[model samples]
Target: MPSGKGQGEPFKLEPFQKLFIRAVYEPQLKLRRVVRRAILSMARKNGKTALIAAIVLAHLVGPEAIVHGEIYSAANDRDQAAIVYKFARQMVDLDPELGQMIELVPSTKTMIARRTGSVYRAISAEAGTKHGYLPSLVIYDELAQAKNRDLYDVLDTSFGARDEPLFIVISTQSNDPEHIMSKLIDDGISGVDPAIVCHLYAADEECELGDEKQWHKANPALAKFRDYEDLATSIRKAIRMPAEEPKVRNLFLNQRVSPHASLISRAEWKACAGESKLQDGEEVYLSLDLSSTVDLTALMIGSVSDPCRIEPHFWKPRDKLIEHSSRDFGSGSHRYREWAEAGRLHDSPGKTINPEAVALFIAEMSQRYRIKGMAYDRWHMDYILREFDRIGLQAYEDCEKGGDGLRLVPWGQGYRDMGPAIDALELAVIERQLIHPNNPVLNWNMANAVATSDPAGNRKLDKDKARFRIDGAVALSMLLGLRARDRNIKPVDIEALIG
Candidate 1:
């Protein structure tokens, strides 16, 4: 409980605790910078919390401490935040000498030095909650589960103010690529750029994930404290679970399993690629990517079938080099009308469609079939949003609205949240819930689709820069919009609430 030496009291640090100390305070560490970022992926009972508490105490009470120093512990959940708090509390409870040196500030979840008034606090990762704080040191525990990326962004901004600020992000790798913790790991390993990152994951070769031996490599205290034997049994069941469920075990438990283990192979994906034919009584989902003068517009119609597939329903401007001929562009052509009338076509006309025209389109589609809500890229489709307001349509906004009718849908706000929206659409497709017409142009967009991951393990559509201009946002929005309309929900009134 009592961590660092308190008033000449006897003290000994754990191995990992000693490592944390050297990583942060060693003068040689500053000189070499051999490891600016490090991951300590120990097993569950490896005393990570206690070690972190000791480090926090070291920063607070160590001989070289700065007066009025500030330190923080951040986590994905409130419970995790409390772990750091509990650890600090334990240090005081175990040693009255240590307790005499520090005062617990109940109001702010902090431990304070009686002589200097330095402070340490615990924080949680909720929306718009992690700002306006500066700390000399930060310890992020169990970061792999962090759902919000904003917390990382806030800390990043704080780092620029002072070069000496110590930033430590630690976590058990989780399935979420979108999680702040996972992104840090991925960025550390990819070494795609100048930064050299450090990570000690279970070597895919050394241990069959879940094997106690394999898990121990990443965790130092596994032999004495971790429940590795029981975890091994669960790993087998996780491998057998469906696409999404098992990912949780693989990521957090450090198991090796493919979450997106598709029943269809690449060849099937290629063969099925534009071969989806619309049948009578089939419902189709439409995705629209609008364009301006330089950008090409796109619309995709995906199946609402068991194979859960998406293909392009339409594409624009056969070739960028070719002139905008009525024949090549197919503007005002019968083929365009055929799909347009079928309500399977999504169009973005290089600029925001006229408010009146969009309103008419939405209304017309709603009357024909359950026209679900539409999804558009908020970043690029500024004009479209204004048009929605001009027409008195409600869209979700994030703000302090005093009971205005505008309910802001938090999920529709950014590229980050768009990942979940796409996953939802994919699930709908796999469930055989969406239907669409097979259009040549739409097929083209689907063919060019690529996948990318952000630091937090979130999957995203990668629009190939060299190939055709494909807007997965547009496609995703169309699907979202359709789903929304079906649910009788309107886009949240972001302006009203956030403003």
Candidate 2:
């Protein structure tokens, strides 16, 4: 079997592997084996399959063997399930003494320890019919990749009749937090069940992307068995391409981050954070995005200058704020209440965000800063227009018709209008030409936001397709769009306005 040091050699357990074995198998206080289940998680290339193979050998023909013992390696699919069986077959083939003792049946991917009368086989959720078999030992490979908990439940329940049944799950962390493997990892760490043992090797979410020291936390076999330079190259690529970062962090760093589908990486969004307080007298572009009664509403005001300073305003109804915040919409992805208490998110008074309150806030801001222009989705602003009129915020067709009247730019949410603006925002972020108040709500919106691109490589944010609420990001993009289109914005005179 292959290992980090070299391939085609007898698989040997490392120090960490031995420690994990001890924790899983060692008996304590009247129990023959303390742990009924063991979960081992780490970054890829840590020789998990090899370790799984070794465990199978230990239980099947080694000291733990029992007559008529049934050992199975389970995976999401047949190909994956066959991995451990292949490795075990190689081990038995290489050893002359073991070759005399074990019978191999390649047709069904099964092995029989001749002396002990133990049976081992590879099974998958796809092969069909997983019921009626009592398993002595089950090693589940990459449980994170499983579509649902059906196979896991079957394997878990199958162990009931055995004397010392062991269920071992070995895999890298899944990108999704809601996966069964994720729950097992969490429960293992929480120490909820004394019978469940967990050995997780993963870097923290805040660990720097390029830190080799931090990389070792997730990759226990780094440099020893795994190639160090190969990992370094991957990290460099992740840093250069922000879109690949989520996968890199999830796969290599063993972090529970979203995969490649994320429109913006966490690192890219974080680099743009700052105290982006728009100067009191600066001419800033204003944009709005309205959400459903159950969702968020956003107002973004920002300077068009370099290092684009932005102050984002978010509102949710007071009644549903706590309830929405508590739900794991993305499975602990959002912390709306925490952000609200920190003075970042504003709470609307009633069950829904009132358009009058939004318009009045705009009118109040116009008192201090000159409303250079306002951009909004044309389809949803009809009701808000009456609120604008009631609050004395007059709308002008263009800057030419605007004499102290707000130039209302009707922005469409289609690719034709939004594609170029999205490009500008992406470029600004990459170039470090944008700054924000380090608002968590805004950051969360951007993190949750995903984009749909055209054949021409023009990409626009799709709120419908996003994993979570993206109101702030949509508003910010519209603000950037207005900032790009209009440049004749006049700065405000604060003292004169007050006088």
Candidate 3:
């Protein structure tokens, strides 16, 4: 191993590095490698890339060497892939003894030890030519930045031929909680696989962001190899600009925080959680948000009286859940599955939401509770309206257009309507006038919501900017808007509305 601290000096392994090497090299009593896969997660400037380069070289021509051994350093892009390879080549060139033994091929980014018949190379996901290569040792550098799992799967599956294959992943925490790197970290934390070893250095969730102690916990080399002054400067900048806080925490604190700006404070949302169930005979207003057929469709019901109770019905395409559950960008579907199994979400059949099923659910809700009116967005109203028509429900015209009966109301999704609705809902939540059943699906959507302000200062939930589905939140806002209208109008005969 070569040191990054100085030129041509033997690398002095940190205590944590030594422990990792021991775990990988020291076989169990059964004479088998204890750890086949290792995941090392830490903040930047922690010598992660250099450490990974050293390990790659060790397997190439050191104690773990094998005849005709194939080792690779893989990353999301070509520049990232070259990082470890360049360091390894530099290490060998800096030392006379290692230089004499190894041959560096800069053009192809390869290092070959002719005597041992071992080779080290660098590859990236964009190359699209990773398949058909059997790798004995694989080092995935900055795996969090990878957009997909194609390269990861290719390299992982290619190792089955080797008797003692080793896969090492070194990366900083990703901003996306649903990313592949985050999934691996979650698995490592669970400790379900005996052959997998994980070392994660991160600040505690409750730790103050400005605390130096928390910074030291996440960055092991804070004052040493990593400059303390540089970090302090960044901390000061983050404090001055609220927009930079999430990026700083993700990169420096190694926390899996959401990259999206929050619409509501998490503390306030959690504070509003309580046991509030709706009664069968209670009069309720229904709101539906059908934004995407293949994505999430949300229906929210709220009681008319004080202590406004809410219940959410969420639907997603079942096939999409199966297709994306194992993907890196598919965290939403995985969570949906969990919520579905918990009986808090509904899984519609095929690749799109079943409008008939949604209509039937509304009919069932109408039978249980006296539904005053249902509010729906006008954009994708055709399918939903047809379903309602098939179910014998009348379409209510706009009150300004000479409408007097209770039916489905076409609610505009612009800033004018959503702005006031959001404000009212927020006030209700703060005043403890709005009660919910503490639904996890709805809670997740609320947490994923991000607010967007129009030029005139009106704000609404921005679906594009939200981290995940905000259909639930949008539905709730619509329900609040309908509730406002319900207070001014009289209820129509149930028989006439259903006919």
Candidate 4:
């Protein structure tokens, strides 16, 4: 019974809460429980904390209690972990029977049963000292916000020691599709594991944002615990501001929208992808965006003809490839390793990028294509420039004259330069005038791209605002800018024409 609201009263469980309790407690046979793992996904402000608190209390001292049983509720941070603990403590204080039977220690965030030696503790991911506990029930609150999978993996696998362990993951949908929580939800939905039960409350993909029916679909507590007036205000804000729509849909509609603000719509970008392949010995312009050893570096090549055909090359360090790939870099670096295995990406040795390998690849590419010009950001290009010189390629500034050979041109990445370039690329994608080989690396980068506008209304792709690497998009934009200025090819002033 919960007692904090007014007086020590019997805890009133909602229909959804009752259903969840039955799902957790109902036995398959005489003593065996049906569900070993339960995934509860819903929108925000849906009484998730209160329900989890009740379940924690039930495990600690109620009929589910076992002798010396250990129960844990974990979150990404200390404050989040304390949320459930605080609510449970309030419930204990409000009820006389619970207050007498439970001993609450606020300092350590632990509650112990007086008769039974069962204990409940709240822990955070940062406290990497959770190795010894053999938990009977583990409640993972807001699993979507977890930074990595270390704590989850440790706790999940440690349940093997218990006879009937229950792992309950209650979370909102993460904006990042590659997040561990998202992956777990996907696996749960596959229904391969009968012991795992998944309850997902989300709006349909075709449902329009701010639709009342869609809102009701995602939020079970719409008129019960959740206030309709507050949701209506949020809907108004989301509909009025285009930038806030994705976040609103993600948090309220339970949609898997991109974490970062997107520069291009996914549908438009997908529409532009085709089976068009770049021909050998074709006249092409190239652009390079170099990064330090630990980050991603990209080289994008494209023909200056109509329906520009683009190809990309990416490189990353080889050391700890698996570990780095598993980390959530919005889209996850696993895609990088996958591309490398497919021979589409270059995995350089050690922790830093190998400039020699990059130069070698460019030199080889120069042999295949009549490389007219190469645009590169001036930052961190000293080693690459020296490597180009070693390969008998000349480095030229935008203002400098060059011979009829492969020339490296210094390209500015500021709004004045990148604004027109991004605008041009967007126009090409929307008009279906650009032909790409449907490179997954480039597609991921494009999905991660976010645009920021200056006071003068000129916009450029902002890397800091983006959730993942946008090097491919940046390189392609630079190449497009250079191609637009070339006298040999008829330039399309896409912005001017559209305006």
Best by lDDT: 4
Worst lDDT 10-window in candidate 1? 261-270
The residue-by-residue lDDT of candidate 1 on 1-499, one tens digit each, is 4432232344456565576556545644445334435555533445567667766787787753567778888877777787779767876767778789888876667888887778888887742454677777777887655544557667656755544566676666653332345557667667663333334444343244435555556555544444455555555665565344335345434532224432212222334333345444355455555566334554444444444344443323223322332232222224333444555444434333343454444434434433222444444456546666676655454344553433333234334655555455444443344433344344334434444657765555655321333454346445654454445543353225335
Candidate 4 C-alpha lDDT tens digits along 1-499 = 3433324556677787777777767848666887899988989988888888888988888878888999999988999888889989988888889999999999999999999989999999878745787999999998888767667877888887788899999999887655778778989999898788778888876467767999988888888777778887898998898778888888888876686657776667778788666789899999999877678899989986878888888998887456567763422236557778888778999877889899888988888898888989888989987988887765565566645556777887888778878877887787787887777778778878898889987888898888878888889888877777674434456557657
Residues forming the 10-long window of minimal summed lDDT in candidate 4: 327-336
lDDT of each: 0.52, 0.80, 0.78, 0.81
> In model 2, what are the clashing residue pairs, if there are any?
4-225
* Clash number for each model: 53, 1, 0, 2
Q: 85-192 in candidate 2: lDDT tens per residue?
A: 787788888788888988999999999989888999998988864588799999999887776566777788887778888999999997655457887998998988
State in Å the error of residue 377, model 1: 21
| lDDT at position 443, candidate 2 | 75
Model 2 off-target regions past 4 Å? 1-4, 7-10, 261-448, 451-460, 463-499
What residue pairs clash in candidate 4, if any at all?
A: 293-352, 293-353
TM-score of model 1 (CA atoms): 0.49
Model 4, position 155, has a per-residue lDDT of 87
Candidate 4 TM-score versus the reference: 0.78
